[model samples]
Target: MNRIEKKLQSLQEKKEKAFITYITAGLPDMDHCAKLIRAQEEAGLDILELGIPFSDPAADGPVIQDASYRSILKGTNLRKCFELVDGVRKDGCELPIVFMMYYNTVLHYGLEAFAEKCAKVGVDGLIIPDLPLEEQQPLKDALAKQNATILIQLVAPVSGKRIPEILKDAKGFVYCVSSMGVTGQGASFHKEVISYLKSVKEQAQIPVMMGFGIRTAADVAPMKDIIDGAIVGSHFINLMEENQYDLDVAKAYIQTFKTELK
Candidate 1:
């Protein structure tokens, strides 16, 4: 099993929820980005999602969109993102790293080459939120050639009927979007969203995780029984922004989330 599957398996053994967090790669700059990346892993992240900054981030909220804008200004490209991953791996950080990027970047970089570079650099998976399940087969096939990076799929509320189809080639886990909106911590899962999540859990053989709008541990406390865990992004981004990108403060913030999870 890859790092992601292994980490989920370990969490399952401990009867604990998995924590997956994201940081836009090369946010302020590569140096500051590396610090936050390591800090998230140290904060007990089961999976670290590094957002590959894009000019047009269609699915991200203002927070992530702003971060991507800054990263773009710093000239963060696909190769540079890989370098960050390589640096983390060489430093002996075993935390699974998932590249949360958009489909346009993949197509621009060439799918096969992108997957090969990810495997060579020790990346564990990919989370392309904009890619539809019907169009994922080509990307999946490319990643399969390397047999290293896994494709993580997102299933929204309206996609309940297609759960089986979405999870058909899913790997790492199923990123069950809690809200249909872009992505922010302020978003909440209503009764209908929860009911939909429960239904998703019923069909997902792999770990079913909730993302988009889930900001705090309290938000996920009631969801443990219905979903595997929650994937947090905007919350941490807001924290880092509030703390002026202080890695220690953000690291401490993550521990607080974990404490609340308990």
Candidate 2:
């Protein structure tokens, strides 16, 4: 099994929920970005969703969009992202790293080449928010050859009946989108959202993680029984931005979620 699967299995064995979070790769420059990654890992993050800064981050809200724009302005491209991962791997960072990027980034990078690089740098999984389930095959096929990185599936509240079909061949974990809109904070999951997640959990063979709008420990509390974990992005980015990109402040904030999840 890859790092993603192994990490999830380990967490399950420990009876602990996964504490996943995100960071825009190369944000505030690569050196600081790598340090923040290490800090988060040390602070008890179970999975690292390393976002590749894209010009049009359609799936993200303003916080992530602003972070992506700043990272892009700093020349953080796909190649640099790969370099960042490689650098961390060399430094012995064993956190399960998943790449969250747009389809255009994969398409332009060439699917086979992209998968090959992921294998080389030890990326455990991928999440392309904008890519439809049907169109995931070519990339899935390419990833199959590497046998290391999983093409993580996403199921939304709006997915209705299609949730089962989308997660049929899922691996790593299923990222269940908590709300209809873009990724941000102050997201509340009502009865319908919880019901939708229940349907997804029933349908999914892999562990299901709730993403989008998750910000605090309180947000994760109600979801404890419903999901295997929570994925926080915009909130984490906002922490860094609000603290002037302080790694220690970011680490302390993540520790709160980790404690809550445990």
TM-score of each: 0.96, 0.97
- Candidate 1 TM-score versus the reference: 0.96
For model 2, the superposed segments whose C-alpha errors exceed 4 Å read none
Kindly list the per-residue Cα lDDT of model 1 for residues 86-184, writing each as its tens digit.
Answer: 998898889999999999999999988998998998999888888887788898899889998898888888886788888776677889888877888
Residue-level lDDT of model 2, residues 95-192, one tens digit each, is 99999999999999999999999999989999999999989999999999989899998988888878878878889999998887788946755458
Candidate topping lDDT = 2
User: What lDDT score belongs to each candidate, Candidate 1 first?
Assistant: 0.85, 0.89
What is the alpha-carbon lDDT of model 2 when measured against the actual structure? 0.89
Scored by TM-score, the top model is: 2
